[model samples]
Target chain A: MTNRNNAVNNAQKSWLYRPENHKKLWWGFGLILAATVVVQLFVSVHGHFGFDGWFGFSAAFGFLSCALMVVFAKLLGYLLKRPDNYYDDDA
Target chain B: MLELIFPPAFILILGAFLIGPIRAPLRPLIVLGAPLLTLYTIWQMGDGIQLTAQFLNYEIQLIESSPLRRLFATIFAIMAFVGGLFAFRQAKWWELAAAQAYAAGAIGVSFAGDLITMFLFWELMAIFSTVVVWCGGTEGARKAGIRYAIMHLVGGVLLKIGIEGVMVHTGSIEIQPIPLTNIDGWLILIGVLINAAAPPLSAWLADAYPESSPSGSVFLSAFTTKTAVLALILLFPGQQILIWIGLYMIFYGIIYALLENDMRRILAYSIVNQVGFMVCGIGIGTEMAINGASAHAFAHIIYKALLLMSAGSVLYMTGRRKCSELGGLYHSMPLTALCGIIGALAISAFPFTSGFISKSMISQSAADQHLMMVWLLLLAASAGVFLHAGIKFPWFVFFQKDSGLRPKDPPWNMRAAMVLLAAACILLGIFPEWLYRLLPYPVDYVPYTASHLVTQLQLLLFSGLAFFALLPLMRRTLTISLDFDWVYRRLILSLMNRLICLLSCLNTALRNASNRVFSIIWTYIGRHHGPEGMLARTWPTGSVVTWVVVLLTVFLLFSIY
Candidate 1:
C-alpha cells in the first residue's frame, strides 16, 4: 500500500506545484500587474470620462472594486450564508 | 397538398422525438446532425418573414429572417451541436432529448416574428429545461427543478399577460422596440428580465443549474438566458430602466460568485454578470450598442460553454465539485486546464480573445453617449468579472491547493467539444469581423486599440493581484450565499405553513364560539317553554285566585264610589 501510494505521489508534477517556485510566481504576477499600469504612461489612454485618464486608474479601480466586493461579501455572509446542504431537505 | 414552410426549430424538435426511440449507436446522427441541418436552413433563408399563421384572428409571423434573428439562431444551433457532442456519451437519453427540445425552443424564439410565437416557444424552453434539470436524477435536482419550473412558469405567465394586453389594446403583436410607456411594456420587460436571470429572480439560474449533472449544466448554461437577452434586444431595447437593472445583476453575480463554494455555481453566477453587459448594451439603444449585445451573446455562448465543459470535465472524472475539495488536477488533466484557462481569459476580455472584441463595443457605446456614471460602473463591473470569473474560477479549481485528485481529462468527445469552442473563442477574438459581419448593424468599432488593451489588461491583471493578495479572505467555506429565491425556497413555504396553522386555529375557535352561542339560546328557549315556568306553571293557580279576589274587592269599591 505504501508502494502504491508513493507511485501516486511520484507521478509527474509541474514546476508550478513545487514549493520553491511559489514566491517567484507571486513576484512575476506582481511585475506583470505593474507593467500593465506603467506601459499606459508611454501610450496615453484617452478617456471619454476625464478622471479615467488619470494614471493607473484601471489598476486602482480594479483592485479596489475587487477588495471592496470581497469585504462586502464577508459582511453579507453573516446574514445570508447557510450550510451547503441547506436546500437538501426541501426535496 | 400540404404546403408548409419548415422552420429550423422544427428540425431540432423532430430530432428530439427521435432521440428516445432510436438505437444507441444511431442516436449520434440525430444528436449531432439535427443542429447542423438547422444551421444550414437558418443560413439559407433570405432576409424576410418566411412564414405566417393565424393566431385566433390576427395573423402572426412564424418565421422572420433578419440578421439579428439569424445570428441568435445560428449560435443556438452551434451550441446544440457542441453540447450534444459533450453529452451524447454521458447524459441519459431523455436528458439529451430535453436539451435538444430546449435548443429548439431557443431557436424558435429567435425566428419568432411576433409576441405570440415568442411566448409559445418561451414556455417551451421553461418546460423542457425543467426536464433537463430533473434528469440530474438526484433528490436535490428534483427539488431544484421544481423551483426552477415555478420561477420560469411565473415569468412565462407574466410574459403572456403582457402579450395579451398589448394584443388587445395596441392591436399588434409585432416584436418591436417597446416604449416602457404602459403597464404592458413594463410587464414584458420584467418577464424577459426574469429569464435573463436579472436580479431577484436571477438566483434561480445559480440555484438550479449547479445541481444538474455535469453535461446537463453545459446545456443549461447556453439556452434559456441567452434567448431572454435576444428577446430583450428584440422587444425592449433602449428602455432606460434596464441600465440600472443590468448594473444590479452584474454586481449581484460577482458578490454571490465570490461567496460560492461549488465550481459550477460560480460559472452559473457569472452567466448573469455577462448577460448584464448585454442587457446594458441593449439599454444604451444605439446601433453600436445593439451590435455589441448581439455579438457578445454569440461570443458568450462559446466561451461560457467552454468554461462549463471544463468544470463539467472535472466533475465527470472525479465526482467532486466543490472548489475547496478540488486542486492539482492540472497534472493529469492538462488539456482541461488549458482549455479552461483559455475560456477564463476569453471571458475576462484579454486582448486577442473573443470577450475583448465583443464586450468593448458596449463600453464604447456608453462612452459615446457620455454617461459618465454608467461608464464607470461598467468599468468596475468589467474588473469584477475578471476577479470572479477570469481568475478565481480557473485558479481555485485547478491550482489553489493539492487536494490530491489526479483524474485524467474527460473522454475524447467532451475534450473535443472544449477544444472546438476554445478555438472558436480565440479565432473570434483575432478576426472579430467574422462575428461583426453577422451583427444587425454596420461595424465601425475596433477592439485592438492601444488605449483599450492597456487599460483592460491593467484592470484585469490588477484584479488578479487582488485575488491572490486577498486569497485568505476568499477562502471557500462549505456554505451558500442566499438570494431572492430564498423567498420561495425557504421564506414563502415556511410562511405558508404558518398561515395554514393560523387558519386552522381560527377555524376551531370560530366553531367553538358558534356552538356555545347556539346552546345558550337553546337553553333560554327551553326554560320559557317548560311546564314549571311562569307561562305554564302550577304555582300560578294560587296567585291567580288571590288576584281574582283582590280584583273583585276593587270592583265593588269602584262601583260604590
Candidate 2:
C-alpha cells in the first residue's frame, strides 16, 4: 500500500489530519503532562535542593522558565533579527 | 628501534589525498577503510607514549595511548565510517576527501601526548574543515567558511603561543594540567574555548555549519567541537571558570536556537548548548564529572549527527531548510521524522535515551558538590533543552501546519546511516554501562533511579507544555538573531567604512587647504614679480630707483653697525 513517497496512504489516513483528533491529541498530551506531576505524589521524588522537593516544583519551574525564555528570545529577535537574506549582499 | 615514521595520522591523511587520485570505484573503499584502519592502530597500542619522533630539537610523542584517548579515537573512527556512508554517494569527491583528513586530524589530536602534536593536528582540522565548509559550494558557504577559518586560526594562534610559551618557560611540551598562574595557561584555555564554540565567538558554529551541504553538514556536525572537548578534558580539569563559561554557552545556544529559523542551525546552536554541559562537567573536575563529560561527548556526537542526518535528509529531498518554509514532512518522511524525534528526545535527556544517562552525571556531580545555584541553573537548562531542541525542532520541521510538501526519506545509504545512529542512541541509553566503562574515570552513579526519572520526566513534559502554550511566540520567522559575530560581520565593517569616509573627507580638506595657501602665496609673488607687477613693468623705473635708494640706505646702516 505504500508508494515510493511513503505518504500516498499516509497523507489523508494520518490521524493528524482529522479536526477532532487535534482535540484528542491535545487532551491526551495534557493528561500525560498533568500525570507526570501527579505521579510525583506517589513516586517519592527527591530533589537536590529542599525547595525542589515541594509538590509540582519542577512542573511550575519548567513551565515558567520556558515561558520566560520564549518571551526573552522574542524580545531579542526584535533587536537582532534580519531577513534571512541579510547577509546575501555582504557575502 | 621501531618508529611510527608514517605517524598514525598518516593513514587517513594519506587516504584523504589518495581519495582524490584513486580510481573512482576504489575511492569509496579508502574513504571507509582508512578510519577503520586507524581505529585498529589506536586499539593496538596501550597507555603511555607509543612512539616518539624528534622534531627539530624536541622529542614529541607521535602517538600516546590511554583509555581516555582510545575512547575518543574509537568514536571518531565510527563517526567517519558512518559519515562516509552518509556522504559518499551525494558529496563531491573533494569534500569526502577533505572530511576524511579532518577526521584524521581529530584522531591525531586524541592521541597527541604533547601540546606540539596537538597543535599540529588542531591546525590540520582547521584547514580541511574549512575546505569541507567550502564543499557546500554555495555563496553563503564561501563567506561563512571564511569566517569559520578566521575564527579557528585565531584560536590556533592563541594555542600555539601558549604551547611555545610553556615550552620556553617550563621546557615541557608535554600536554599536562596547566596552571592558570600566568597568561600562557589562560591563553591555552581561551584558545580551546574558542574552538569549543564558547560565547562571543559561538556564532561561527551556527553561521558556518548550516551553510554546508546536507551531507557536508552531517560530517561538519561531528569533529571540531568534540575534539575541543577532548582537549579541555586533557588540559584543563578543575578550573572553576569553565563552569560559568559553560553555563553562558548553554543559555546563549538555547536562546539563539529559539530565535533561529534554519533547520540545521537550530541543531548547530544546540551543539554549543550540549557542549556546555560537557564543559561544565570538566569544570566540576571530579572523577564523576569528568566521566560524565567524556561520556556525554561520546553520546552527543552520535545524536547530534542523527539530528543533522534527519535534517539533511529533509533538505536533500525537499531542497528547503527554513522551518518557516517546511512543515508536514512527517507525513512522507516517517523514518526521518522518527529518527529526528529520537535524536530530539535523546538530546533533551528524556528517560531511556543516551542524553538521559550521560547528561545526568554532570547535574549529579554539581549536586554532589552542593553547587546550589549552578545545579539549579543546570536543571532549568535541561528544561530549556527539551523546550527548544526536543519539541521545537521536530514540531516545526515535521508536524507544523502542512506545507503540503511530501518528500520521501532520503536515499538508502543516508537512511541506513540514520537508522544505525538512532539505534546507537537508544542502545547506549538502555545500556549506558558500556559507555560508562569507557570513561576516563569510574562511574558509580546510576542513571535510572526512580526519583531521578520522575523529576526529569516532569521537567521535560512541563517544558513541552510551555512550548505549545507559547506556540504563537515560537512560530518560525524568516530571520536570524545576531550574536557577537555581528560586531565583526556588520558593526566593525560599517564602522570601518565610516572611518574611511571620514578620513577621506579630511584628506580632501587638507589637500584643498594646502592648495589654497599655495595659490595665495603664488598670487602674492606673481603680483610683485610677474610681467605685470611693479618690478616687471616699464613704469617700474621710478619704483626701481626707490628700491635702489632703500637698498643703499639698508647697506649704509649695516656698514655702520
For every model shown, what is its TM-score relative to the native structure? 0.92, 0.94
Please give the RMSD to the true structure for each candidate, in Å.
Answer: 3.9, 4.5
In model 1, where do residues sit more than 4 Å from their true spots? A1-14, B1-5, B511-561
lDDT at position B58, candidate 1: 75
Over the stretch B119-169, how does candidate 1's per-residue lDDT look in tens digits? Answer: 999998999999999988888898889989999999998988988889888
Tell me what TM-score chain A of model 2 achieves.
Answer: 0.80
Per-residue lDDT over B1-561 for candidate 2, one digit per residue giving the tens place of the 0 to 100 score: 433334557899999999999999898799888877877777677688888888888899988888999899999989999999999899989999999999999999998999988999999999999999999998889999999999999999999898888988999898889989998998898899999999778989999999999988877888999999999999999899999989999999899999999989999999999999999999999998999999999999999999999999999999999999998899899999999999999999989989999999999999999999999899999999998899899999999878889899999999999999999999999998989888887778989987888888888998998998899888788888878888998899999999999999999999999999999998999998978887866765789799999999999999999
**Number of clashes in every candidate structure?**
0, 0
10 residues in a row with least lDDT, candidate 2 chain B: B1-10
Candidate 1: CAPRI quality band: medium
